[model samples]
Target: GAGVSQSPRYKVAKRGQDVALRCDPISGHVSLFWYQQALGQGPEFLTYFQNEAQLDKSGLPSDRFFAERPEGSVSTLKIQRTQQEDSAVYLCAVQRGFGYTFGSGTRLTVV
Candidate 1:
């Protein structure tokens, strides 16, 4: 079984630009989640999905953030009009019972 993996592991974006971060979750996992972690802070849940259904997205910070798991396995987070405040680690995790397996994350830097 493959563990969750994220690409780039880092990103730098100019203000007002857009960026896309990718995540590949563990095979056979049915639940996935996205979270944003700011420096010196805990991860804040951004969105969640079960299979192909987006069950919750209330934690998305703003309209600039969008996420999707169209095929129920791979997921992506897109940020539009990136801002300096959006510079943070975007983490993807897959649920397994009481625990979750997380990716290293894409560290976005907006300058």
Candidate 2:
């Protein structure tokens, strides 16, 4: 894709269910980022990947949160045992040329 792309723009999940959010960065982009935006708050960095290696994951809230980009193009963020606090917009972005390409994001709501 010419720009970043994400699937399942909206999602509703049971309290204990697990969800996987996907993102596809623009072609040839080498940097990727995952951010979580809670309602009424700014997006917070969740993880960052430079090519296949995950450069940083300290921003991930907990062990239940996992992100990966094995092939360095498409990435996925998985959350286990969804909780109300996990409800937010998951944003994916790719960095290049001193700027970023961002996806529309996936909205997740856990009941």
The most accurate candidate by TM-score is 2
Model 2 superposed RMSD (Cα): 1.3
Off by over 4 Å in 1: none
The digit string of per-residue lDDT tens for model 2 on 53-75 reads 99999999999999989998999
The worst-scoring run of ten residues by lDDT in candidate 2 lies at 1-10
Clashes of each: 0, 0
Tell me how far the alpha carbon of residue 96 in candidate 2 is from the true structure, in angstroms, after superposition.
Answer: 0.3
User: lDDT per prediction?
Assistant: 0.92, 0.93
TM-score of each: 0.95, 0.96
Model 2 steric clash pairs: none
Error of 1 at 86 (Å): 0.4
